[model samples]
Target: MMGVVYTTFMDMVAERFSEDVLDEVLDDPGLSTGGAFTSVGYYGHTDMIKLVVRLSQITKLPVDTLIEAFGEHLFGVLVGKYPTLAEGRSSSMELLEVVDTAIHVEVLKLYPNAELPEFRCERLEPSVLHMEYRSKRPFSRLALGLIQGCAKHYGETLEISHESFDSEEQYETHFTIKRIQ
Candidate 1:
């Protein structure tokens, strides 16, 4: 069994990810070559795939090393935030903010399109976050890119950017997102 911090981190990561990438890949069949997937659409490029390819070409290190590094860094965030993961409920609200900050601080460098200027947790119950983004188009491709990119860095179980919206067309209005684990 995974340690509490490790498990919580992974679960949180998965919650932020899994959805948008799969949806992007499945929705766009012509996304990558050979019908083989290495692109996770997180950075709007097969950069994740290319990063692997480059690593493979440069050295003999196993690809799992790359993934584990991400997992390790993610775990570090959780451990730093809540050193006693095993003894607590692992407050979902706090976990959400931690993961969100991790994405902005780290993942944004990898996907430098729209910066997450402000991602505050306006309302935590039922997992509602009041977000205010300054993007080229509020409901445009860049917006989706921003959402999906951040989701990938969560411990490994986040689908924060995937679920269907009760509504999402309005530019200057509120939206609902499925609360992430």
Candidate 2:
């Protein structure tokens, strides 16, 4: 997709996407549009054919093409933040300190401050990274909103793909990821 456009839009929202909301939207069958299209404004699923037409015309990009591009873009952001979520595998072990289980990605484009938890991150291994973050107790709406944005931008299954940590120190850990299929 367009990095400059996407980042600029995300910056305005100040939040990342989440998986739950995305999944709900995707499962609707109305929002499919074969791929995420902006033609119909994603208003609803009342009419699938109209939605498809709008999606195609809105972005000027094919529905299937948009879908593939969207997935690639989201996954790219996921891998980029892998260090922030995987704290233990890294030598820095900084991002691992997070108490929230939200993915640190750019998918959150709908809400302000909807990005991942505020934390420090460092790369320890070529294949592994680490992060450090903190959160009170219980998940916050903002956090949930961020994940929803991710779902809207990417697929929905990503949220469920997350693995939470019981320890107060390790807020959450993502073991099996990229399950957006």
RMSD of each: 13.2, 13.7
TM-score per candidate, in order?
0.28, 0.23
Cα lDDT of model 2 by residue, 1-181, tens digit:
2233233223322233334433333343544344343421432223333432444454465654433333334433544544345434322122222323343343344233332345444444432334333344222222333333344443344422233454755354333222233
Candidate 2's C-alpha lDDT?
A: 0.36
Maximum-lDDT candidate? 1
lDDT of each: 0.39, 0.36
Q: Which regions of candidate 2 fall more than 4 Å away from where they truly are?
A: 1-5, 8-55, 58-61, 87-100, 104-112, 115-181
True-vs-predicted CA distance for residue 101, candidate 2, Å: 3.2
Runs of candidate 1 exceeding 4 Å displacement:
1-29, 39-89, 108-118, 123-181
Model 2 TM-score? 0.23
